[model samples]
Target: MNILTFDVEDWFHLLDHKSTKSEKVWLNYESRIHSNMERIYKILDNTNQKATFFCLGWVAKTYPEIIRKIIDKGHEIGSHSHLHQLVYEQTPEIFKKDLECSIKTIEDICGQKVIYYRAPGFSITKKNIWAFEIMHELGIKIDCSIFPSKRSHGGFPSFKNQEPVIVSYNGITLKELPINYYTILNKPIIYSGGGYFRLFPYYLINKWSKNSKYVMTYFHPRDFDKNQPIISDLSLARKFKSYVGLSGAATKLETWLNNDQFLDVSTADQKINWNEVPVVKL
Candidate 1:
């Protein structure tokens, strides 16, 4: 079950190290996703492919029809936090409130209980493992937050098993469908999504997907927009992370989707028995 997912945030929501200093700039950009979303919607509609879209609560609130359109078009909707803040940066109380708000807002708009979540910037790391327990308390059933290996921002490097694993926290069990990774020379290497998917050749991703049951691929709306305005005064690492690959990402992704049969997280979950979700060892 190769799964293709999307992190549905506007381009600007992606925080640069410079931008993190001031979040007030975030409100300047309103509805930065329509054009790219239309492109993606048309592409998916033409190809007859369905995916899980982890969208922002604020976006869903402003454009309720977009959520309906996603449901009507036969895709699953999941929660990507309301404010797009990193999990490590928030206190547990604030984190839980944001999770609840996001779920509530999306559910109110879409008229369905949002059960899945993907943290902003893949922010679920060892330091914030407690957040998963908070999610389970909020009735979230699945999380696509844990990117297998470490990145500059945040990730679960030691926990990069590169497979769908159920992680039980407290007495609650939530399925954690982590991002894809490859084992190279007795080391786990992450090669899915973000700049990694763009900078490296697409064939390598296809090859990696062939080895795993599910290739969890994710892209932001900004990935498809080459004309997106450049962020001024970004750090060196942030510049590379945000703007490395713009030319052929969509085409490469389309090629992969055309060649293989993949399932969204919702569909794949339906096929499995959730009566006994795994308990993550502490």
Candidate 2:
């Protein structure tokens, strides 16, 4: 199943960067989430598709209308943390506090219990596998934080299964929809979302989608906002990774939405026979 999900943060929410690190400096950048999210809504409306959105508490708190519109449009919402901090960088106590704040923020806005989560930049690697237990304790029932391959900020390469699996960690089990990859030249290459999705061509993406049985996609508001200003402090490599293929990404996403039947996380969960899936003991 090809599942559609969006990391509902603004362009400046780029993790690990000093300028966009905290809410104090976040205001320095232009607030483009409103317009960018409009693009997403238009595309989804045209395609008549549903998606799961992992949103920042700051966003929901700052822009309650966005959260309300999401619910009104019949989309599922999940927590993407409060301040957009990396899970591994913060202490477990701090992480729990931030997670609780985020969950409470969104829950307060929509009056819906928050049970789904995704760390900023998928920052729940082996070093911070404790995050799973913490998330479980915080009432997160489904997690999409596993990258399944090497990533700059966060990835759980040691977690082998690419598809949906019962993630067993620290005596706690949770449903995991890890990012799946396409094998190219004996290497696991991800082309389903973010920089990878923008870098790869549609032909290869189509081929890869046809080849794989389960696909989980993670997109951001910035992916569709091509006119966003550049954060000059970023390194040359990060600059390129962040802005490359912006011009055509929206069209590509539109094409993908029109081509394939993508389901939201909740729907995908109901369709899966969890008992039959592989259990990855972390």
Candidate 3:
């Protein structure tokens, strides 16, 4: 099954960057969320697609209309966090507080409980496995934050399952849906989202998507915004990774959706049988 999802954040919500790091700095950028989101909504509409939108609490608070629109359009909603930050970098207390704030903020806007979460940058590494307990404590039923391979910001490379699995940690269990990876020369390579999605040509992505049995996709508004302002301080490699192939991203994705059948996270959840899926202990 190919499940569609989006990280509901502004173009400026880049992770680990000094200038794009926090709430205060966010105020300094141009608010391009509305325009970017319109493009996404239009794509979904045109393709007759339903997707889960993992949103930031700040986005919910700053523009409640976006939350309302997502619900009104019949899409699933999840938390991306209160402020976009790498989860492994945060203390358990900080992560919990931020998560609580996100749940509260998003719930306040849409009047529905937020039970799904995707951490910024898929930042829940082995070092921060305790994050699962906190998410379970706060009522997140399904987590989409495990990359299951090595990543620059953070990734639970030790995580053994890329498909839907029951993740248990310290006596707490939560349903985890991690991104599927392509094996290249004995290494797990991720090509489903962010820079990887943009980096590879659509024909190759389509080929990979066809080869994989289960696919979970993660996209951001900035991925298609070719006109987005570049962060001048970013290193040369980071800049290339962040901004590569923007001009064709939206069109490529539209073509992708046109080619395949996809469903939202909630629907994907319903399709899974917890009775027989693998259980991973973190």
Kindly report which residue stretches of model 2 are placed more than 4 angstroms away from their true locations once superposed: none
TM-score of 1: 0.93
lDDT of each: 0.80, 0.92, 0.91
| The candidate that achieves the highest lDDT relative to the unseen native structure | 2
Worst 10 residues of 1 by lDDT: 14-23
Query: Which has the higher lDDT value, candidate number 2 or candidate number 3?
Result: 2
Q: Per-residue CA lDDT of candidate 1, range 1-282, in tens?
A: 778788988777766555543456666665568888887887687667899999988778767887898898889999998878888889999999988988999999889989999998888888898998899889998899988786766788877456677886667677888887777797765666777787778778778778876678888878877788877778778778788887787787778778887678888798656665445653
**What TM-score does each of the candidates earn?**
0.93, 0.98, 0.98
Residue 263 accuracy (lDDT) in model 1: 78
- Which runs in model 1 stand beyond 4 Å of their true positions? 17-24, 273-278
Error of 1 at 48 (Å): 1.4
lDDT of 2 by residue, 1-282 (tens): 999999999988887478656698777677999999999999999999999999999999999999999999999999999999999898999999999999999999999999999999899989988888899999999999999888889898888889999989879999999999988898999999998889999999989998999999999989988899888888888888899999899999999999989999999999999999999887
Which ten contiguous residues of candidate 2 have the minimum total lDDT?
Answer: 13-22
> For model 3, how does the per-residue alpha-carbon lDDT over 75-158 read when each residue is reduced to its tens digit?
989999999888888999999999999999999989999999999999998888899999999999999999989887888888
What pairs collide in candidate 1? none
